[model samples]
Target: MRRFAPLALSAAALITTLVQAAPAVAAGSVPGGGHPAGGHRTEVLELVARQTQTTFIDHGDPGTSQGDELVLAGDLLRGPALFGRFGEVCTLTRVGPEPDSFDQQCVGTLTLPGGDLTLQGLVSVTAAGPGEVTVAITGGTGRYRTAHGVIEAVNTSETETRLTLRIIL
Candidate 1:
């Protein structure tokens, strides 16, 4: 049951609920990689986000699930890319009785100039004291088709969240 909860949280609810509204990619736009071939490159995109909305859906009763929905608009703070946005709707299922630890999948869409990139991944929040979470970019669309990277989100304030994406490939 321990492994099953986290697996279900990741597989069943995360992808379908997180990704929402995104603009279409423009034709003839260049791909996300703005680098020359034949070497590994690490690109960092800093995004400043303001929480647009949030909804707490479940309280995590013994037989029930726990989770919430988060929406935010992120502006490019530093990077070659332009503006972006994402919406996360997910539920909380714990691996154990750890108060600060839980397993959940967040579904969200990362919209960029080229087009709307579907963001799907599993987030394992080991601690909850600080609202900081790390996510793995499992897959996406358009220029990000083969995209994989690490995203770190830190809450600066009640309504502000700082996101840094160390994107590779």
Candidate 2:
């Protein structure tokens, strides 16, 4: 232990120096919280969704086979205020029985005031309808140009879906 003291001290000093040189990454501020430059932060967005339109496109065998697509569009709300809109395209990737037996590849977008956030992932389809999915934020446009994160989407009803976003730049 005696011989290891100086080496341990040097290692601790190096670690301290590295931590001091690293950038500060506190959780991001809210929308009005002034977007700081080059900060690794998380911006949270909570919105209620009202699905306005949906369509099914049959491919190949004209049934619920692979490549069948479901397209959905909706309005987004914060409380009673309608602030944005969203659209999603889901393609059947696997077909099986009900509940957890089916999966669909989904790509979606959130059209907000300043920009749009895109997402892609697999959504599990049940006999009732499309369930919930956590998707990767594939990039964005305008103010969200540098955006990349995850979105949690739940289909609360046939006409409603809820969304929560963790956006990082």
Candidate 3:
């Protein structure tokens, strides 16, 4: 499948977030149009990621199997400007006999000016051609320390993808 071509883990991993993580949002802190979610402050961000590189590691087998890994690198963009970049690693935790049936456990990060957002999810391919996936926002490194949300990615090409990030701070 074309969608499974690369970054099956790096995101599947960086669909979206950012803003000046200025100490606090002052209650008026909704950047990119966000609202309160379950009483927690929230924000939404848009981004584009163009996959620049991919590394596939085949382990213990000639073809796809458990222990296989995919490493991905790409750039993050907000509109036409460079927002930041991202990196991800996905491991084949489950492999089915069919090529399109497998799950990748992925951990990825979006390195931005304010902070780094972390994402983790189980990426599975259930269809052909360009694909789409949604993963969870686990945690972060700086201002995004309390950041949690979800990333939805749609493969625009074999090497290009669009990301939507819903961040809850």
Candidate 4:
């Protein structure tokens, strides 16, 4: 027992020193966060989406009697991965007190590969035509936490919408 005392004390002291010197490791990460620039990472992912399904909700309100407001929801398909989805509650608030010709104050969310991008701003459709609408990206989370840019959605077909998202920082 006396002979083993020195060895045991040395081992204990070594372990204490190691523990004190070791950098703190995150639960599921190795020393530094899994990615080199976890929070400082900046990237751009471009994808084209074809509309899978779209629905327009009728409010039936006097203000929207002429269908000035279009409550829209839809899903989009991309490659073998069907990921992008969006919903818009918008109205023909610009260039119209009537229907069939105007822009809209559209509010919606676009679920991308990284995360959901909360969108809003004027959706110009009248001047661009039935197949195209350009919108502004307000904010988002996850990979797109500090995202800002323009998204141009063009209806490629009767059941398809091509979305171009140019993300900045």
Better candidate number, 3 or 4, judged by lDDT = 3
Top candidate on lDDT is: 3
Per-residue error for 104 in candidate 1, Å, reads 2.9
Could you give candidate 2's per-residue lDDT for residues 1-89 as a string of tens digits? 01001100000000000111111122244543344664566787766656666667878875567787767777767766787887777
Instruction: Give the per-residue Cα lDDT of candidate 4 at 126.
Output: 33
Which residue pairs clash in candidate 3?
A: 15-163
Q: TM-score of each candidate? A: 0.57, 0.72, 0.78, 0.58
lDDT (0 to 1) per candidate: 0.46, 0.58, 0.67, 0.44
For model 2, what is the C-alpha lDDT against the true structure?
0.58
Worst 10 residues of 2 by lDDT: 7-16
Question: What does candidate 3's lDDT look like per residue over 1-169, in tens digits?
Answer: 2223455223545331122211211123454335533556666676677678888888887677788888888887676677789999888787666656677788888888789988888777544422557889889878888889888776555665667677788
RMSD of each: 9.1, 18.3, 6.7, 25.2
lDDT of 4 by residue, 13-49 (tens): 0000011111112112123223465553333333334
Error of 1 at 111 (Å): 0.8
What's the C-alpha lDDT at position 71 in model 1? 30
The numbered model that scores best in TM-score is 3
Model 1: per-residue Cα lDDT over 24-131, one tens digit each: 222222344445673545556555444444445534454324543333333433233446656555555444466455566566666655555444555555443223
**Residue pairs with backbone overlap in model 4:** none
